[model samples]
Target: MEASFTKVKGGALVLKGEKKKKHKKTKKRDRSGERDGEGGKKLKKNLEHEDMNKHGGWWQTTNLAHIVGPVALQFYNGAYMKALDNGKFVLGAPHDEGQGPEPEEILMAMKVGDGKFSLKSGFDKYLRLDKAARMVGVSDAVGAMEMFDPVWEDGKMAVLGPNGRFMSVDDEDFVVFDQDKVGPAQIIRIRSNREREDMKKTEIPEELRGNLYQVETKFVKKFQKFQDHKLRLNPNGVAELVEAKRGGNLHETLLDRREKMKSDRMCK
Candidate 1:
């Protein structure tokens, strides 16, 4: 018989030209409970998978402090550090300019210390500094050579490899950590899935929702009742309300203040 090869679903090559014997069909077993349990497990697995991929887009990190989680290091020329299937890294352009990095360019960054981190590539290899001072993604685990320190200065970020040198791209577009000082080539933008710091500042708490005096005034307007739609604020400073809030009696304090103003309908 002639032998042939066939490619399987998972990129595996298998030998063909074999005749297999069929087995006799037996009575089906009642495995409904087992099937339901397996279905539930698959649903849970799918939910977790969705959650992991939810935070996919990228935002630039202003400082080294925000360089954790899934990240991509882009050089000044708009090229991202992409890992190849051969366990090598190169500067590759993104499919979309501002959308985000491709899977091969995204790295899972884990903070190991105050300023140290370990980056894992899509190939399931940890990026490390080889003995030749070249950046490679061949390590299966995070070792000393896998630890990297991020440096932020003058609004630019640079990475320090395990060899205590700054990482820069060479003329061949290969990553090397041999530079003693940071320059245009060494200036990298570490982008991640984290929200921008300025955006986070826009989120205000419920109690502290508006301007200090405006919040109290709005409460007075809501509770105060008179023939005219007028707001009567106490001449007393907001120090009492601020203090009462710390003591968890802000509502009572506001009512008392409104009552003192003789404007609260409940006080009548």
Candidate 2:
């Protein structure tokens, strides 16, 4: 090995032939990629949850008079009514808390008459009261035995079968219409996947549900006393209508706008 020379503080020469120690450079890990991946996964999960809630979440029906759609019946035992493959109906446990019922557990309720509904299963079979007094899913078409009347009282609901008996769940988890009166076993919660109807939307006329300008024009044509049918609109923008809509006073604001134009018949 070649000897190298080093000068000390006192001008003394020292042999420095040792090889230079090489150090391995450690590269820092890119945590931003992992963080982005995790954030993307969380966003996707949240979007999936919101989409599921849009069409699959359960909501208790406050009015039994209008129970006509896809629904699930939950018994007092925390089980949902389900249709079996063997032409029978049973109460099955939910998979998780706040989870909606499965496809087999969903029933299509058709309003047959006042307070009467016909429940059809996912198998396209109508639920009927068999001769054995058991609720079965074997009928293809709705008949007298398929008609059910839902009764709501004190925020509770009960199903009355064609035989004038209340539907109840047995110890074996089977559903039957053998009870004469509504009891704990007979009480059920009718849940639907449909969104609740907004009372405000109901109060607004169907034709007046467009933009503010369109609503104002329609109102002028409907309530204007002038025979010329000319629309007299306020020169000021519809900013007040937008605010009124958010405050649930859109109708009053529209009337005020029409009164300012002197075109409303009821303004006087």
Clash counts per candidate, in order, are 0, 0
| Candidate 1 Cα deviation (angstroms), residue 169 | 1.8
State each model's C-alpha RMSD to the native. 20.0, 23.5
User: Per-residue lDDT tens digits of candidate 1, residues 1-268?
Assistant: 0011122346645469766544453223336667878999998656634533542456666655676778988888777898878877888864443356778888988888666889998888899877768789988887788998877654557788878788888777778898877777888888787665544556554654676488788787776677776767888888987898789887788878878788445466
Give residue 211's error in model 1 in angstroms. Answer: 18
Best model number under lDDT: 2
All candidates' TM-scores? 0.55, 0.56
Q: On residues 109-185, what C-alpha lDDT tens digit does candidate 2 reach at each position?
A: 88886668899888888889777788898888877888988776555678888898888987787899988767677
Taking all chains together, the TM-score of candidate 1 against the true structure is 0.55
Candidate 1: worst-modelled 10 consecutive residues by lDDT: 1-10
Candidate 2 residue pairs in backbone clash: none
Off by over 4 Å in 1: 1-57, 94-97, 196-198, 201-268
What's the alpha carbon RMSD for model 2?
23.5
